[model samples]
Every structure is written in structure tokens, then in C-alpha cells.
Target chain A: MPILWLFLIVLAIAAAGYVIGRSRAVASVGGDHRKMHSLASFYGSNVAIKVFVPAFLFTIAWLLVQPIVVNATVSDMIPEAAIADNSSRGLVMAEVRRIADGLDSAVAAGGMSADFARTPQTDLDDVTQRIKDAGGVVTSDITAPVLNAAQRYRAMNGTGNFIMSGLAILIALGGAWWGIRESHADFRARNTVETSIRALLIGAASIAILTTLGIVLSLIFNTIEFFRLYPAADFFFGTNWAPSFSGRGGSSDLGVLPLLWGTFYISIVALAVAVPIGLFAAIYLSEYASKRVRSVAKPLLEVLAGIPTIVYGLFALLTVGPLLLEIFGKDGLGWMQAGTAVMTAGLVMGIMLIPFVSSLSDDIINAVPQALRDGSYGLGATQSETIKQVVLPAALPGIVGAILLAASRAIGETMIVVLGAGAAARLSLNPFEAMTTVTAKIVSQLTGDADFASPEALVAFALGMTLFVITLALNVLALYIVRKYREQYE
Target chain B: MMKDNADERIGVDAMDIKFAAKDVQVYYADNHAIKDVSVDILDKTVTAFIGPSGCGKSTFLRSLNRMNDTIPICRVEGDIRLDGQDINAPEVDPVQLRAKVGMVFQKPNPFPKSIYDNVAYGPRIHGLARGKAELDEIVEKSLRRAAIWDEVKDRLDAAGTGLSGGQQQRLCIARAVATEPEVLLMDEPCSALDPIATAQVEELIDELRQSYSVIIVTHSMQQAARVSQKTAFFHLGNLVEYGDTTDIFTNPRDTRTESYITGRIG
Candidate 1:
């Protein structure tokens, strides 16, 4: 309640400072030097900001300290015996308060003895009768101290409120005065204001770095815990990835090699489907196609990118799987299964990321200055020859960057893998067979009702850590390649 | 539909005379950039197009090889007869036209490839070389013709972009030469090069007149006087005067040409 009052007083002071500054400026509105920058409101705002900001900070600081100081002083007044138990003191204080309330009611009801009332009674008699009625006896000795402490509490509360609000007003007034005094020539207001803003920007940037560090550390620590019982060699080298070791009768098999194989196999398939098609589309747009063809084709290509990955996952699961199976299923070639497999998901993912790769590669290709294209054309080279021999080579670094970025996204992809890719993790060479990726396993292992303290749950973190490291390296490499590309052109 | 004037052009060029454009109109989107323009370029001669910026000299140069067609919104309506042959025929491929009429830009633009590869690109695309030895000889001969062979002969495997500015421009010329084109066009080729490189390129241009007719666009009036046999003065997208280099400089036919030549106006 006192903090609310102090806040009001501080606000009033700030408003007064703004009015005063604006009026002072208004005096010079007509003919005084004709040199004031910004506007009267901006000056008023500056004054108000100076008056309010420091006072608010100090008030919040004092509020934090007040409770701690009051608690220490109040706790010190308690007897050492009550402090020793620590637990019994709360119950004892409640009992004492109940008796005091009963005594006050008795005095109001005119049921107390005149002699007892005359002495400004200790309320001991009323408590005795009330305790007897309840069939218990908590002595009246704690009652006297309860009355004494309540009286001291109200006084301390008043003093704290007075001092805190008074300090807030004084600080605000002092700030306004200082600001008015410093309003002279050669005072760099913009520099002071921008320095504060620079500090804020730095604070915002540090948060991104810190968040990445925190995630890495968490993955590392949990993965370490997972490695305590399960050996790292078994996790990385063994083929079968059955986490249910208890069901296997002492056979514990959890391997990442199969998952890693699945990840690479799918990524390779995705790249195969994407690169030639994407690069050709990019070249056509950047080199040969007219503006009309490009305008129609470019956004149509980007529509595939706009459809969410989960939709692509559904398409893979419901459509592509069935379609593939019909062609290679029991009814036809009988080489593939009825459910999702590596090819179905990878093809869909490749379709989804085609624009992701192509648009970026297109920009890079287009950015390879028109001068280079002119140089090629002047030499009698055909359009395709020019793009293949000159433009693509110039744009190679940026294309590599775009591909690496897409690959990193693919490696860390969760929704599509979780929905479309199969659950079984086995080291296999066939693209027709169903297989699982690292992301699919992570989602499965983490969301299931496994005990948090066990190695099974902790292994998710280990997988997470491995996934983080791989993607981080891919991103850093992508950044390095992009920077080199920029340096070449710029 | 395109018109074929190759038959007419062959007979006229066999006579060793000048090609002429009667009237040319250039439009960009809907804005008329160049009004009815006419000029003549003589055989075995260096013709200079001199004007202030945006006077459409470069536009006229690009029109010679249908380079204007590369720009989507640009529209050209004109009669440009090269040796009496109307160049814009329906059966005519701009690629072939560009091959026969090569160009060097205002800025030196080298391919980001090896010097050998850069020079060999045009020959490879046009299938002008029969074998490795032939292609090598062609590449070397073109480089020697551009006058950068001694400096870059040993570094043929090095990236073309790694060369100095003057060498890069010569490398561009070599690349153009590898296609075995007939007429060479230069648009402010010395603007981005140093004085020494400019002298070297100018000297090379004089030697090139033995086989290929050359047209140059220059901002410097002194350059036109120094390197050209004939000069065409343009102002506000109009060809104001075109005559012998001596007559254009010493006694211009038009007032605008006179003011520009005398440094009164650009």
C-alpha cells in the first residue's frame, strides 16, 4: 500500500517537471534565438523521462529491501526458545490472536468485571474462559507479548511508508532540477540518449548467444548422465535400437548407426531429387526465361515451399506411400511395403524444400552482376553455356550456403519424420524399406511415459546433443561459405 | 517475323563500302528513348559516338547486334543495314548475330574462370576449334592479338578474375576474338582503365582495323580525335552530325555538335 502511494507521488513530480519544462520552452516560442531543436514536447518528454526513470528504479530497490529489513527486526524480537523450534511459533501466535479477539468481544458485550476493566485489562481472564469452553488450556502469557508486538508493528509500518515515499519525491525533484541546470549549449543530449540505447541492443544480442549456450550445456549434462550406465560404444556402434532392454531378457541394444544411416540415406535422396531440378529452375529464371515466364513460374514453385511440412508429411503418409506401394506393392511388383518408407518421405521433403533451395540459388545467380553475363554474351557463348560456365561458378559459394542451410533444416526436421518416417531403426541399404531418423527417435523417446531419472529418458538428451553438434557445424560451415561468397562479389 | 538481308549485304560488303541505318526509333516500355536516328559506319574504319550521358549512344551501339532485344521492355523499329543487309531477320538468331558482331563493355568484365578457359569459352560454344592443339593455338593467337599474351601466357591456368584491370579488359577482347567475329564494338572501353592501358587498347584497336571494322563510344572529345577516322555526334537521342573525324572536330555541320566539340555544351 505504501509502495502504491510512493509511485503516485513520483508520477506527480514527473508530470510537474514536464509542465515546467514545456512552459519554459513556450516562453521562447516567439523570438528567443530561434535555435531550439526538436520540439517543445520532445524537451518536455526528455525532462519527464529524467525525472521519473531514476526515481522509479530507486523506489523498486527500496521496496525489495524494506521487507527483508522489517522481517529481520521482527524475527529478532522473538524469544530464542520459540526460534529454536521454528515450527511451533506459528501455531502459538495464532492461539494468542484468537484469545485477544475473544477478550475484545467480551469488553464490548459488557460481561467483564469492573475492576478488571478499570486496569485496561490484559485480556487474560477472557482467554481463560474461552479456552475452558473449548476444553483446552493454552496459557495467557503469550497474549501480553502479542499485544505489545501489534502496537510496535503499526508504528514501524507508518515510519517505513513515510520515509520511502518522501525519499521518492525528493529524488524526482532533485533529478528534474539537475536536468534543468544542465540544459545549456554544448550539452550532447543525443549522445547520452543513444549510449543508453546501445546498452539495450547489446543486452538483446547477448540473450540469443546465451540461449544457445544454455541449450548446449543442458544437452551435454543429460547426455553425460545417460552415458553413466549405457556405454558410449554400444550407443554409437550397435545395430538394433530397441530401448526396451527389460523385454529382451538382459539384451540391451540401442544404436545410433542405423539412425545415422537412415538420416544420410534420406538426405541423399532428398538432395538427388532437389538439386538438379532446383538448379535447373534457378538457371532458367536467372539466365534464359523472360520476365513473363519467370513471374508465372517463380511463385508457383514457391507454393510448394509454403505448404507446411506437416501437410507434406500427411501427403507422404496417405498418398505417396499408397501410390508407391500400388506400383511396388503385392498387387504389382511386390517389392515395397504398404506403409511409409524412405523414398516416400524423402521425395515429399525434397518437393517441399525445392523452392527453399532454388530461390536462394536464383538470388545468388542473379546477383552475379549483369556485367559478367554481358561479358559472356559478347564472347558468343550460348545462354546455357554462360550460366553453366560463368554464373553458376560465381554463385557456387552462395548455392553451397543455401544447400547447407536446407540440409541442416532437414537433419533437424521433426514433424515430417515423426509422421511419415517409420519407427524401426535398422542399418539397411534398401530405399524401399521403412526406416527412422534421429529426430523421429528423439520425439518418441522424450514424449513417452518413461521415468525421467533413468538412462532411457536421458538418452534423448544424448541424441539431442549429437543432433545439436551436427547442425551447429553445418550452420557454421554455411556461414563461412556465405561470407566468402559475399567477399568475392562485394 | 524477321526480314533477311544477307544476300544484299554480301554484295555490298564485297564492294568494300559503308553500312548505313536510314531511321531508327527505340522505345522502352512505352517511353520513346530515341527518336528517328540515322548514321553510317564505314568499312575498315574507327567511328566514334560522342555525347553526354543518356544521349542514347550506347543504345544505338547495342542495336547493331540486336542486344536491345535482350531487355524485355525495350522495343526497336528501324532499318539498320550492315553492308546493305537488314540484320533483324526472323530466321536470324541473336546468338549468331552476337557471334559475328562482338562487343567490349565500358567496364572490364572477366569470367570467374581460368584465363585459358575464359578465352576458350567462345570457341567451345561455337564449335570453332577442331582439336586440343587447334583450340590452344586459337586461344594463344587471340591472347597475342589482344596484346596480353606475354603477361598471362604462363598463367593460363590461373583464374581470369585474378588479373589486373587492363589485363582483364584485354582478356575480354581475347575472349571476343576467340569466336572469330567480323565486327568488334567498343562502348566506353577505356573509361574504367588507366591511361597506359587505354593507349595499349587504342593501339590494339588501330591494328584490329586490318580485318575487323570497329566502332567506339567515347566521352573524351580528344579520344575521338586521337583514335577515330570518322565521328558521329549525338545529342538528346538524336544523331546531330556524322562526317570525317577531321571535319567533325575542325568544322562541325550542326550547332549542337559545334558547341559540344568546343566544350560549350555536352
Candidate 2:
């Protein structure tokens, strides 16, 4: 049976249990709700939880385990000689599973008979033709041992699914019976229901944390593997960033220094453009702007954040890069060589981050108590003087945290650098020079047909891990600064 | 209304009036907050305005320094003169007016700076001192005048917000006095403080009457009788009675004033 159908059947059983348990409890209380320990809905939910939780858990576990067990048994059935020269056991097993599914479809499509599909001694070419006629992809001709293994794999999977459905239904029925038996007036249904809800909430919270841990662990393992192939010292300190494919048999120098330098240079340029413009915009919006102006202007400024980064990348590549080139290219100041440079990407990225910095800083500035402003104004200070001396100082730590967050966003940006900053890894001080960041290189290295085990591809994970650590450190520092500043006022 | 001889009423000369207002009216949006209040406040004396909550005493006090100008919907009308000059004239600047008339709010609101810096803020902004030594001298004088110098003298570098409730209120008073204003407007300055702090602030206010004209708004009738020489009683935005504190508390003027002082009505 399909998993969706099985899910629906379990839901139907639980719904039935809910109705029966609610009615039984009411009947046991002689239609007087005051005699019951909990409300009628609580009793219904308790029965539903019992009927659904264990049965669904069992079904999920069986679904996960059946394939692994079936694959192992079927893989053992095929002899070693049956494996092709270019293929391993894993690949052949994949082929067997595909054929097994194809056979089921072929039988359904009436292109092959069920009896012929179950038989192991049939002609391989005839079976392949029938599968093809039924619109199944057959890479090559099937051998006798492979055909037998596919047949056995199919049979075992069918039996496993059949038994799974039966056992799941049995558990649901047993849960229903137990729930009805406990549906007396004195049963503590609300307590059981509340505890189950708390468990469910904890389970949800842990899933999010566990997923983050899993991603970090995977990155760690891959990064360790990369280190074994390439020296950690060279990867860390070397200035060159050149990755030669394994097929070329040439040594590759995969240094992270040039990438880190590029990342920092671009981020600094971006922050230089963003901080003053963003901060001043926030100050004006929060302090000087009228209520009607602010109501319209705040959301309009936030619209900049809602624009996609990829769209910004296109804007850089098509408009901003060329605009910068016209001013500083050979025809003008002779500083830039091409449209794609660190300056181009950095400028566009800064424009993208305006709303991010302004929105956060505006909120922080607005959070500064009105009492402070009143004190300054009461002492005959002008509005500008009051904001400059009192308001800005109080909001400085929070603004710094906002700037750090924007810096992290800048460092991790990929699409803008890919389109605006040319893919040349070099350490230079010139803003007009073409440069590439770690994130852009990661994207380049992971795409295409590079072997996953090669140092070239594995280096992406190392870059990712390094970027993760840097951003994580930045975020922690920002949070610490914000928290320390908050303690002063509260 | 009956007009009595000024010397017979309070034994004070009439020429000592520092602030004279005629037919003052204040509005917040469409709501009239203060209605046709006319009074003369004497210099070198503490005057108190006693009223129930929302009776417009604070509104009248804030208009003295033009603090009501900060609120978008608040509007004030009529003639108010300080030292025989119309303060509401177009040529007069509110900033300079505020420097001449400093205010302390109901709640203690110290700037988030060091105690020295908090006291130095007003003088620094108004260019009252020409050098750092002069600024420091001004800070010390102001803090001493506010009567919190001995308690915080050793910790001038400490954050002003770190002080206790009473100390913070005193620090705010010091900050207000740093500009060396001629008049001080205190709007319920002791409401947020305990009794000890209130008593301390009241003593400071009594001492402040030696040099500057002081106006205070209060809820406690006994507080008015304690710290003020002249008292004005307000009920429902109307000035019900204005006289010496002893006569207002003892003798009957309006039936409403008598009822309020006798705890029959507020």
C-alpha cells in the first residue's frame, strides 16, 4: 500500500477512537459533565493520541528498515561474477531495484504477464523489450542472476509492506480498545493529554537543533577528509588559489588566503558604502521624519531588503559594473580594466544591505527611551545636538551589532560576486581589480563534473566550514555586545 | 473675585513679582486643559500648585518654560512675561527660554552618562563655562546646590543612572540648576520617591527659594503647606483659590476650596 493511504487509514482509526472514547466517558458519567475529571474534548484527544502515536511510529520505523534489509538479502543473492567490470555491488543493486519497479509497472501496463515476471528462467531480451514498451528505462541487457535477484527483491518488498500494514492496523485497534477501557469518569485524561503535548513540543524544538548539528558534523567530516589529502598549513597560509583537476595529473595549490582577503576587502568596501548611508537614513526616518512620511518611507525602504539577491546580482552585472567602469576605466582615470571588479560587486552588495542595516538600526534608535531625549532637550540642547550626544551614544552598541550582522551577510554573499566580481583569486589592494570570494569559489568548485573525492571538490566543504565558523563567531560577538548594552538600561 | 491688598495678604511687597501672567489658556488638541488662569508669582519664594490628578497643574507649570511646545497637539495662549519681557513673543527663542527656566520632571531621569557629565551637560550646552576648570567648578557648585554633593562626591565618574532613587532625583535637580536659570519648574518631583527622598527634595526646594523663583506642582496638600509660601488650588482645570498657604489651609475662600481642604471633596 502507498504510504499516504496507510496514513489516511491510521487517521480514520484515530478519529473513530476519538468519537467512541468521548461517548463512552460521557455515558459512564451518566450525562453529567461535573462528575468527569476532564472535559469531553480532553478524553477524545487522549484516545486519539494513544491510537495515533505508537502506530505511526511503528509504521515509520518499518518503512525505514524494510528497504535496507531487503536490499541486503537481494544483493547477497547475486554472485560476484554477475557484476559488470565497470559496476560495483551498489550500482548493480540500484539497477535491480529499478528493474523490479519497472517489472511492476510493466505488469500493470499489460506489456508483460505477472507469471512471466515472477519466473527467473525467462528470456532476458523479451523481458527487457516488455519493460521498454511499458516506458521503463533499461540501460542494458539483463543477466540470469541479476533477473533472479530483481525478482526476489520485489517479492520480499511486497511481503514486507503487506505485513507492515497488517501490524500497524493491529496496533491501532489495540490502542483503541485500551483507550475505551480507560474511558471512565475518574480517568485523568487531561493530564495525559497535557504531558503528550509537552513531549511533542520538545520533539519539535530538538529537531531544529539536531539538524544544525547534523550539518556541522557533515561539514567537519568532509573538512577532515580534505585535510588528509592537502596540508592544513598550505591551505591556511598559502596565497595562491589554483585547483587542477585530478584527470590532469597536475598539482593544485588550494590556499584560502586570497579568498579570505577578497572576502574582507569586498566586505569593507560594502560596509563603507552601507554604514553611513544606512545609519543616516535610519536616523532621519526615526527622528526627523513626520508620522505620515515615516509610515510610507519605512516600508518603502524595507522593500530593498525584499528584492532577491540574484536580482541584485543582475543589476550589478548589467548596470552598476558598467557605470563604475565608465568612470574609472582606461578612458577615464585608467584604474579599472573591466566591468567586473571588487568595487562593482561591493557597491551593489552595499545597496542590497541598505534596508537590512537601516531597518535594524532604526528600531534600535527608536528603542532609546524618550526620557533621555527629554532630558537633553530640557537642558536647552538643539535637536541635532541631542541626537548626536545622547541618542547616538545610547544606541551605539546596538548599531555596531547591526553593522557586524551586515558584514557577515556581505562576506557570505555569492551571486553578486559571481556576476560582478570576476573569478580571479589574487591578493591586491586595488578596489578596481577583479577578485573572487570564498563563497563564489565554493559554488564554482561544487558544480560541474568534478569527482567528489578529489581535493578540488572536497575543498568546498572546507571553505564552507571556515565561513561558518567566522560568521558564527561574528554572530556570537554581536549578541554579546547587544546583551551587555541592554543590561545598562534595564 | 475680590482683590485684597498684596501686603496685607502675605506681608510681601507687590514689586517682587517675577512672573506675571494674564488670562492664560492651554489646549491639547480640541480639549481645553487650563482655562483663564491669572496669577503673579514672587521671586525668591516657593509657590505650590495643588490639584487632583489631570487638573492641569502640570500643564500650567510646563507652559512656563514652553515645554508644552514639544507636544504636537498642545497650544498655549495669552500673555506671560518674565522680567517684564513677553516670553511668547516671536523674537524670543524657546531654547534660550528653556535655559532661563529649567525643569525637573515627576520621575527621576538622569542621562546615561557619568555623574560629572550629567551635571556638566546644561552648562556645556549653554556655554556657561569657558574652560574645563570652570566647567568642573560649575558642576561642583550645581551638585552642592542640589544637596547631593556629599553622597556622590567620591564617585563623580560613576554612571548617573547607578544612583539610588533619591540620588538620581537630586542629580536631575543638579542638571537643571547647571544652566543657572532664574526660575525652576518642578513637576511633582517627589512623586516617584519614598518619604525620606521626598523630605530631602522638599528641603532642597526650600533652600532653592533663596536665589530663584520656584514653582512646584503637588498632589499632597500637606506637602504644599510644608514647602510653599503661597499656594494655588486647582479643581477641574480651574484655579479655585490662590492665597498664602496658611490662609488657604485654614480660612474658607470658595465653598469648593473649603470642601477640598477639609477632605470633603477633591
Candidate 3:
């Protein structure tokens, strides 16, 4: 059965369970709901959840496991001699799986009979021609060993799916039966439902956490593989960043220093621009602006954060870059060679991060209790004096945390750096020069038709892992500072 | 009813009026929060404003120092003179006016700084100290005056927020006194404190009265009787009576004041 149809069938069973479970509880209490331990809907939902949740979980597990089991059993049927030269067993297994699908579709399209598809004596060329006429993708003419493997693959999948459907439905019915039998006046349906809901929420939360863990694990493994092909010391300490793209076995200079420096330099420039402007804007909004002005200005400032970084990248490329180049490039001071440079990307990225810093700092500044301001004013301190002496000091840790978080964002940002900062892994102090960051390099390294076994392609994972570690550390520090500050006032 | 003999009870010639508010009507947006109210707060005396919640006692006290100016919706009409000078005059800077009339809030609001910095904040802002040494002297003197010198004299570098509740309140009082204001307004300064802290603050208020005109707004009638030399009872945004504290408590006057003091209605 199709998975969707199976889902609908289970849903229908759960729906039936709901009605029967509610009526069972009502009948147990002589049709008076007040005598029951929980509301009538609670009883109904309890049975529905029991019937649906486990059966759906089982269906998903069966779907995921059946393919692996069928693939393992069928791939063994193709003998080693049937495999072609310079190709892998895994590749031949892929061909067998595709042939299995094609044969199934050929039978379905009525171009071949089911008995002919199952029989081993059927002409191989005739089966291949029928599959091609049925518009199935086949790499080459079907051979006997591949055909036999495809047949076995199809049969096992069909039987596994049939068993899965039967078992899932049986479990749903069994759960519904138990749920209805337990539906009595004294049964605590609400408590059971509460526990299930709690488990559901926990499951949802763990999905997010587990996905993060999965990403980290994947990055770690690929990075380890990249290191195995390249010297770790050279990758970390080498000043050069020339990745030679000469096929699978080429020597590449995958140094991280130049990229790290560029990332730091751009981030520093961005922070230098963002921190003061964002902090001043936050202070004005939180302390000096009238209520009418604040209500309008705050959202207007926050709108900057809503603009996509890609749009900012384009702005840097087409607007700010040229504007700066006209003054500092060859047309003017002759200090810069082109519009795309570190200064262009850094400035535009700063503009992108202003709202991020300002919005967060504004909230942190506002969180400084009004009583502290009142106390300062009552001491004859002017507004600015109070803010400088009391408010800013009180909100210092949180503001620093906000700035650090923005720094992490600047480090991880890709589009702006890719477009505005020219992708040249150069170690230069001059702001007008072109440079690239870890994220931009990762994108450039992964986009082409490069062999994955080479250090050139696998280095992207290492770069990604580096970026992730830096950002994660920054985030952890920011959270620590913000949390410590909160405990001060709370 | 007793005659309006406020002049006879305190011997008016000996006491100097520090603040005099005449026909002070306050409105918060459209709400007439404080009706036509007038009172003379004397110098070097503890005067307490006693009333139920939202009776405009704190409002009237805040108006004395123009602290009500912070609220955007709040408006004050009429004259509040400090030592015969109209404090609301356009040329009179509220910041300078606040320097002469410092306040302590209902809750202890110690700045998130060291004990020394918390006390030195006002003095530094007002430029009252000539140098670091003089600023240190002012801090020490203020802490001594607020009666928290002995307990916190050792941990001057420690954060004021880490102090106990009573200690923090006294530190706030010290912060207020550091400015050397002529009049000190306390809005229920002991409300967030325990009885022990309350007694400590009440004692500080009495000591502070020797140098400053102390105006306190409190909810406890017994607190008014215990700490104040002059008492004003407000009811429904109106000042029911203002006179010597002893007379307001012991003598028959307005029936509303009687009902409030005797706990019949608040």
C-alpha cells in the first residue's frame, strides 16, 4: 500500500476509537460525565492518541528499515564476476535496484506479465526492451545475474511491505481495544494524556537538539577524513591558500591562516562600525526618545534586520562598493584595484548587523530596571549622567553579549563576503584590499565538479567545522554573559 | 472640632519652612490625581504623609521635588516654592533642584556598582568633591550619616547589590545624602524592608532630620506617629488635615482623619 493510504487507514481506525472510547466512558458512568475522572473529550483523545501514535511510529520504522533489509539481501545475489571493471559493488547494487524498479513499472504498465517478470527463463533482451518501451531508465542491456537480482529484490520488497502493513494495522486495532477496555469512570485519562503530551513535546524538542548533534557529527567525520588526506599542521599553520584543482590526486595548499585573518579583519571592521552606532541607537531609543518617537523608530530600525543578507550583498556589490571605489580606487586615490574588497563587504555587513545589535541591546538596556533610573535621577543625576553612571554599567554585560553574538553572525555570514569581499585568500592589513572568509571559501570549494576524495573538495567540511566551532564558542560566551547579568537584577 | 491651630502647636517662629506648596493640583492624563492641596514642610523636622494607597500622598511628596516630571502624562499646576524660590520657574533647572532635594525610593535601588561607587555617584555628578581624596571623604561621611558605616566600612569595594536588604536601603540613603541636599523625600522607604530594617531606617530618618528637612510618605499610621514631628493625612486626593503629629493623633479634628487613624475606614 502507498504510505499515504496506510496513514489514512490508521487515522480512520483512530477516529473510530475516539467515538467508541468516549461512549464507553459515558456508558460506564451511566451517561453522566460528571461521574468520570476527566472530561469526555479527554477520554476520547486518550484512545485516539494511543491508537495513532504507536502505529504511526511503527509504520515509519518499517518504511525506513525495509529498504535497507531488502537491499542487503538482494545485493548478495549478484556474484563478483558480474561486476564491471573500475566500478564498485555498491554501484552494481544501485543498478540492480534501478532494474528492479523498472521491472515493477513495466509489469504495472502492462508491457510485461507478472509471471514473466518473476520467471528466470524469460529472455533477458526481451525484458530489457520491454522495460525501455515502458520508459524506464536503464544504464545498459540487462544481464542474467542483474535480472535475477532485480527479481529477488522486487519480491522481498513486496513481501516486506505487505508484512509491514498487516502488522501496523494489527497494532492499531490492539491499542484501540486496550484503550476502550480501560475506559472506565475511575480511569485517569487526563493524567495519561498529559504524560503523552509531555512526551510528544519532549520528542519535538529533542529533534532540534539531535539535528544539531547530527550536523556536528557529520562535520567531524568529514573533517577527520580531510585531515587524513592532508597534513593537519599544514592546513592549520600554512600561510598559503592555493587549492590546486588537478583531479583526484593533486597537491593543494589548504592553509587556514589567511582565511582566519580575513575573517577576523572583516569582523573587527564590522564590529567597529556596528557596536558604537548600535549602542548609541539603543540608548537613544531606550532612554531619550519620547514614547511616540520610540514606537515608530524602534520598528523602523528593526526593519534593517529583516532585509536578506543576499540583498545586502547585492547592495554592497552594486552600490556601496562603487561609491567607495570612486573615492579610494584607481579613479581617485589609486589605493584600491576594484570595487569588491574587504572594506566593501565589511561596511555592508556592518549595516546588516546594526539592527541585530541595536535591537538586542535596546532590549537589554530597557531591561535595566526603571527603579535604577529613578534612583539615579532622585540623586540629582541628569539623564545622560544617570545613563552613563548607572544604566550602561548595569547593562554592560548584556550589551557585550549582544556585540559578541553579532560578531559570530559576521563571522558566519557568506553572501555579503562572497559578493562584496572578492574571493582572494590574501593576508593583507589594508582595508581596501580584497579578501575571503571561511564561509565564502567553503562555498567556492564545494560548488564545482571536483573529486570528493581530494583535499580540495573535502577541505570545505574542515572549513565549515572551523566556522561552526568559532560561532558556537562565541554563542556560548554570549549566553554566559547574558545569563550572569540577568542573575544580577533578578 | 479643634480650631485650625497649626501655628500654635509648633511655635511657628522657631521653625523655618523648607518647602511650601500652594494650591498644587496634579493631573495624570485625564485623571485628577491630586486636588487642590497645600502644606508647609518645615526645616530640620521629620514630616510624614500618611494615607491609603493611591490617596495622592506619594504624588504630593513627589511634586515637592518635581520628580513627577519624569512621568510623561503627569502635570502639576500652581506653585511649589523651595525656600521662597519658585522651583517650577523656567530658569530653575530640575537637575539642580533635585540636587537640593534628594529622594529615597520605596524599594532599595542600589546601583549595580561597588559600595563606594554607589555612594560616590551623586557627589561625582554634582562636582561636590574637589578630588579623589575629598570624594572618598564625602563617601565615608555619607555612609556614616546613613548609619551603615560600621557594617560596610570593610567591604567598600564590594557590589552594593550583594548587600542585605537593610544594608542596601541604608546604602541608598547614603547615596541620597552624598549630594548634601537641604530636603530629603522618602517614598515609603521602609515598605520593602523587615521590621528590623524598618527600625534601622526609621532611626536613620530621625538622625537625618538634624541636617535636612525629611518628608516621608508611609502607609503605617504607627510609623507616622513614631518617626514624624509633623503629620499630614490625605484622603481621596485631598489633604484632610496638617498639623503637629501629636495633635493629629491625640486630639479630635476632622472626622475623616479620626476614621482613618482609628482604622474605621482607610
Q: Evaluated with DockQ, which candidate comes out highest? A: 3
- What is the iRMS for every candidate structure? 1.1, 1.0, 0.5
Off by over 4 Å in 1: A1-186, A245-252, B1-15
Docking class of 1: medium
Across A1-490, the per-residue lDDT of candidate 3 in tens digits comes to 7778888989999999999999999999899888999999888898999899999999989889888888888877889999989888899888898998898899999998999888894577888889998888899878889889988998998888888888999999998998998888899999999999999999999999999999999999999999999999998998999987765544678999999999999999899889999999999999999999999999999999999999999999999999999999887999999999999999999999999899999999999999999999898889999899899999999999999999999999999999999999999999999999999999999997867788898999999999999999999999998897788986
TM-scores of all candidate predictions against the true structure: 0.80, 0.95, 0.95
lDDT of 1 by residue, B1-266 (tens): 00122223333453565557878999889888778898777677778899888899999998888888778899989888776778886777888888988999999888888999989988898899999999999999999999999999888999888888899899998888888878889999899999999999998987787678789999989888877777898888898888777778888889999999899996
Better of 1 and 2 by TM-score: 2
Ranking by DockQ: 3, 2, 1
Evaluated at residue A64, the lDDT of candidate 3 is 91
Question: Candidate 1, clashing residue pairs?
Answer: B2-B90
Residue-level lDDT of model 2, residues A1-490, one tens digit each, is 8778788998999999999999999999899999999998888888889899999999989989999899889999999999989899999998898899889999999997888888775678888889899988878788888889999998999899999998998998899888888898899999999999999999999999999999999999999999988888989998999998655323999999999999999999999999999999999999999889999999999999999899999999999989998999999999999999999999999998899899999999999988888778778888888999899988989999999999999999999999999999999999999999999999999999978788899999999999999999999999999998877765
Q: What DockQ does each prediction reach against the true complex? A: 0.67, 0.69, 0.83
> How would you encode candidate 1's per-residue C-alpha lDDT over A1-490 as one tens digit per residue?
4567777877887788777765565455452524555455555555677888788888889878876775556545556555335446655445544543444444455555423423433766564564445444445444455534433443454578678788878889998886655443334444545665686699799999999899888888889888886899988887878887344223556788888888877887888788778888898887888888999999999898889888888988898889988888888888787557888878887877789899999999889989998888776667778877888899999999999988887888767766666877878887888888998888888785767677767778888888888889999999999997576554
Q: What is the interface RMSD of candidate 2, in Å?
A: 1.0
TM-score for candidate 2:
0.95
Q: How well is candidate 3 docked (DockQ)?
A: 0.83
Clash tally for model 2: 0
